[model samples]
Target: MKEVIRSADPRIAALIARQATQNRDRDQLGLDRISALLEAVGRPQDRLPPIFHVAGTNGKGSTCAFLRAALEAAGKRVHAFTSPHLVRYNERIRIAGKLIEDAQLGELMDRVLDANEELGASLFEVNTAVAFLAFSEAPADACILEVGLGGRLDATNVVEKPLVCGIASLGLDHQAFLGDTLNEVAAEKAGIAKRGVPLVTQIYPSAIAERIGEIAHDVGAIWEPRGLHWEAGVRQGKLRYRDRQGAMDLPLPRLPGKYQAMNAALAVAMLRHQSQIAIPASAYGAAMGWTQWPARLQQLHGGPLFAMLPKGSELWVDGGHNPSAAQLVADYAKRQWTDRLPLVLLFASLQSKDAAGTLRPFKGIATEVLTLPIDGHECRTPRELAHLAESMGLPARPCSSLSSAMTALAKPARVLVFGSLYMAGELLALNGPLPD
Candidate 1:
């Protein structure tokens, strides 16, 4: 994995190598080390612009994308910090609506590493501190921070105040860190809510919603749920949003999948609720047409990988690995394949994931499954995934690599390469750079 990481600066490469080695030896999920690291770095987290912090098992990245688009649409500069860069480490830190430059990123990493030499900070913690340092020095209207793990103890939770906080779709993920149940997961995500801040959320089961509300109340944060404080619906090809402030009609999200509408709406609601930057109605309309999140039902277009397939073939990629995400993918595919086209699945996942549960949703929809391995993660062997697929009554084959699986395609089929972000990263690197 280190060999594949590309940067124009040698210092950036050295910093990444050192952090990767440190992570391999001392990676743990908690805030104690991160807190000390940030303190050593001059407590940059406290100096960020008004922040919009978000957390969830899925859709959090999409939500961040929507927020950036809306802020940029309003002609305001925005700083965004996300996790697990699909192809480049630069993707994790966006300063003023652009990926951080290699020289600047290298310098920031060196400063962070030097300050936290004895703290043994994990890779994610060090990355988070660097982002904060950059954001603190740069000028931006707002900052969007996405939780890298369970929110309560996530490295991004050091912010004491934010303009707004949001929790996108929640489900069972990272069970070892968060709890096993949906309610428990909701509670962990709700940990980002700060005193006097507005926390927006999507509709959820009563139990899950109640738990999140309890956490919000405990932290002195105001809970503004979708169905209660505001609401959004799609009608006649438009998104109808209504809240106490007022009502507005905006274009539907340009992103694929019905779930994205909720994410876009959440961003709209958060912007509308906060008056920090004065987002006009026009910005809301622009966001609907401008936002895009890659690797979430993304269609491959005009690339080496696409040319290898039959004419008019569709190749899609999604990095959804949890059971809840699997169900969403299955539902989306059911609607997409209503014309009854053959669906071929090229999949890989980490070892800790439940392969059976994740693949169960596509049992009837997927015509065949090609199981492969995620190159750098502790993933299930291709043979093990094949056995799981067979038990589920789905035709399965083991492939040594993604290239091998693509070569076995009989015709131009509606192919889906999913199951892990690491696999999606590899595909994007091979196909071409992601669309700007």
Candidate 2:
């Protein structure tokens, strides 16, 4: 999918606009451009602190959040890079423990873009180069990187030797770039495995696990999978985690959804398996409450958008656009709202996503689905989406806007606005508690 970015700072915006015009293909995926770009900028990837590189179809961002939270709780200074900013462009790069200032970000953008005179680098490549440059020049104990797409040729994969590498839950996403089958997608993600580096991963089916183990063996990486190397689960009310080093009873993550516990466990395994960083057992317990990744089943309390709903109504939002992610959201809603309250869905998805697969999980659970169009994106038409939903026996209607849909709700209901992350960003811009 093509990425669209805007900055409030004029200097940054101008550079992004110029770069967008120079490259005709915005979604180019390869390490050649990024490698050359970094070479031109002094090869910052080689000068960074201990790095923790993570890649997967989903939950990678949350894992990064968990890693950051745990490190910060240990009183360590950390740098992180995540993609697809929710509110502002600066959200993608965290310099030590805070977002990069506008002046510094603009300067970095100018430097990276100026170096890309003839490389025809994609926007994401430029973003990666800028992040690496900033991270190399800063002082931090660790740097956590979330892969932008499939791991093998992704720009973030330019880092040769990371302290530890982790793979979150595997799923069939980006089929056009990765592959068609589940094994193919798993191979693409496991490509991050490096020689002698421990490749920590979540549990997968037997066939998929065998495929990943083959790749790990080919690369000479030590495969540390969940079921075999470490185990974690929610037992009685707390999280029970056990590994070779020792066992600890950690607190459950503050983030909603039971799946978050697995993401947190991955972070713990990645941290414990590595020898470069020293993390106390207490840090793992504290990380459960400190971790925060917005737009994944986030609830809105007060804002311009929140006031539009009827009195006593609950507003929830998620940025899940794939079948696997949608299934999680559906399951969570089924468990949380079984008290006879009406469940309404405000949905939108990009043209690249599987709209039918995403909407199929919410068919019997949602009382009604109100379809909307995503601004500045190639999204399915509201009418077409409504027809698709209706065909699946889900009562749906096309609405002009979120305001109109919210206004049409005559009584109190539990409303879930989900699908495209762009739509989630739009809602955050109109609501409170933007991602920081």
Candidate 3:
């Protein structure tokens, strides 16, 4: 998906526009161009601090957030890189405990573009190179790198030796780039394992877990699957963790939904198994309440967009666009809003997504689905989505915009804006909290 970015700084905007025109598909699923691009920029990946590389179909970003919060709470300056920024491109790159400033971001983008005079790299490849370039020069104790795509060929996988690697909850997503089957997707995520490095993962099905074990064995990695080596969950209104080291009782993540408990546990597992940094038990508890990932069950307290809605109405948003993600969202909605009537959904998705499968889980949960087209991308048409929803026995209607949808609603209700991350980003811009 190509993003049409709007930056507050003119210099930064101009540099981003210039870099957007070079080799869009050159780094679709390979590291050749990225390696050359990094070499041109002095091979910064080799000079960085200890890295904690994370990859999976879902909850990987949340796991990275958990890791950063715990590290920071322990008085460590942490650098983090996450994808599909909710509002600005600056959200993708975070320098030592802060979002990169405008002047430095412009300078870094310019430096990377200037070095790639002969090499045509994709936008993501250049962005990855810029992250390593900046992290190498900045002073930080640890770095958390999230894989933008599948783990095997993602540009972030160029790091030779990481302190630890983590794989979060796995499901079917990006089938065009990864594979259509669960086994193939698990393999792509397991490729990040390195010799002598601990690959801490949330337990999967028997066959998928065995497949990942095979890859780790072939690469000489220490494979530690959950339920065998370490495990954690909300047992009695408190998070319970147990491993070979010991057992820990911690607070659950403040993030909504039950799935977040596992993500926080993955971060705890990664931090505990690694020897690079020493974190106190208090820091792990601090992370549960401190960590926040926007557009994932985020509620709008007050904003320009909120004033347009009806009174006593609640607005929630999420960036889940796959079948597995939708199932989780539906579960959260039913458990949270069972008493509320007229559960409305304003949704859109990209062209390559499985719209039918994505909407299947929410058929009976939604009161009315308002379909809209996402701006500046090849998105599903509103009429097309409405038809699909109807086929699945859902009450759906096509609308031109949010205002039109609001006017068409019959009564007060709860609204959930979900489907595409790109759509979630646009909604956040209209809503509050632009990712600092």
Candidate 4:
């Protein structure tokens, strides 16, 4: 059964891959294709439980993780769908707190592929349809859907009425698809808002905020902008949340980084604002301490990667690839290494990313940069990355492979593997480590 699924369905894979490569010009902003595909599948998207549709350039995944954890803590069965799976394709679809089984994934893919034979739907569109189909068939109290791309025409946006829509920390990314400016990006993320739904968002620059607000108002969504409707701050080693409903004192999120606190707060606010799921205060605390999103500032342990490092040595991995993510990573590393800094970085990014801007934050923080390829994806050559590092006054070397890079480390030094989530997935698979 696994073989049948794993074997290349050339016709399907080729079509999907082709769609992934197509330039999504702004003119291509409509849900016609996705709606048609879903309708052929019996409109499973309409049958889903209350959805928490999230869109952003960063922090959206962590927000989704917090939402699922909170719902599960309240003893509710939650279905979740995320994108660009780190390791297994199954990671994209979760049913009632479990990754979709191989057989079920295969069946759903078959149905979607069959339906798209004439429609030529994009890979994301087919996958979105499959996720809705599975979520509808399964019994769950709520669903958390993460946007696969810019929200306006993103396949996931086909869901007309989400319980609540959220836009996390936004930044410039996918410039080819989205736009060049931050305001353009904000408008794209804000496209998930629906009529009468609460569109929760983090505070952005005034111009960007106004654009998002305009989009929300245009859609008739009640915009719950941060600093106005809800806010959260870290004080006394805890996160304090306040909104019109009231205030709540919550423990810090188990997830590392100060940014996660905001993501957790967004989840809490979205839940608090919605009426479908009755999440108790206890669930908020549980979410703060129980949620874990892998490959985001994750410290590697008990794996082949760990074995290669010296005892007491710290090794961390994050899939952060853009400038905003780079800034966050820099802030976290700076706080973590006030006394001791990371020895080096094994870094690589897709051809389209701003490699120079992304690595700028690591200047002076990393002892050296060892560049390598991100398998199964278009990647910048290690030499290219090394040149960029050199231009920025950082010591760097291009390595042919990860093993070669690891072998070059002389002693136990803190190391970080970053740049692309696809690379992180390859590392986890090679180390036989499964995401929790």
Identify the leading candidate in terms of TM-score.
Answer: 2
Per-model RMSD to reference: 2.0, 1.0, 1.3, 3.6
Global CA lDDT computed for model 3: 0.88
Q: Which scores higher on lDDT, 2 or 4?
A: 2
Could you tell me which residue pairs clash in candidate 4? none
Worst 10 residues of 4 by lDDT: 1-10
The Cα local distance difference test for each model comes to 0.88, 0.91, 0.88, 0.86
In candidate 1, what are the lDDT values of residues 210-302, reduced to their tens digit? 999999999899899999999998889888999999888888898888888888999998888788789878988998889978889888876
Q: Rate residue 363 of model 1 by lDDT.
A: 91
| Residue pairs with backbone overlap in model 1 | none
For model 1, the stretches where C-alpha displacement exceeds 4 angstroms are 1-10, 21-27
| Cα error of candidate 4 at position 199, Å | 0.4
What TM-score goes with each of the models? Answer: 0.96, 0.98, 0.97, 0.94
Candidate 3 Cα deviation (angstroms), residue 250: 1.1
Predicted candidate 2 versus true structure: per-residue lDDT over 1-436, tens digit per residue: 5788877788888999988876655566778888998999899999889999999888999999999999999999999999888889999999889999899998998899888888878888989999999999999999999999989989999999999999999887789999988899999999999999999999999999999999999999999999999999988878889999888898899999889999999999999999888999899999999998889888888888788888989998899989999998899888877888889999998888999999999988999999999987889999999999999999999987878888878888898999888888888887868788
Model 1: C-alpha RMSD to truth? Answer: 2.0
Q: Between the candidate structures 2 and 3, which one is better when assessed by lDDT?
A: 2
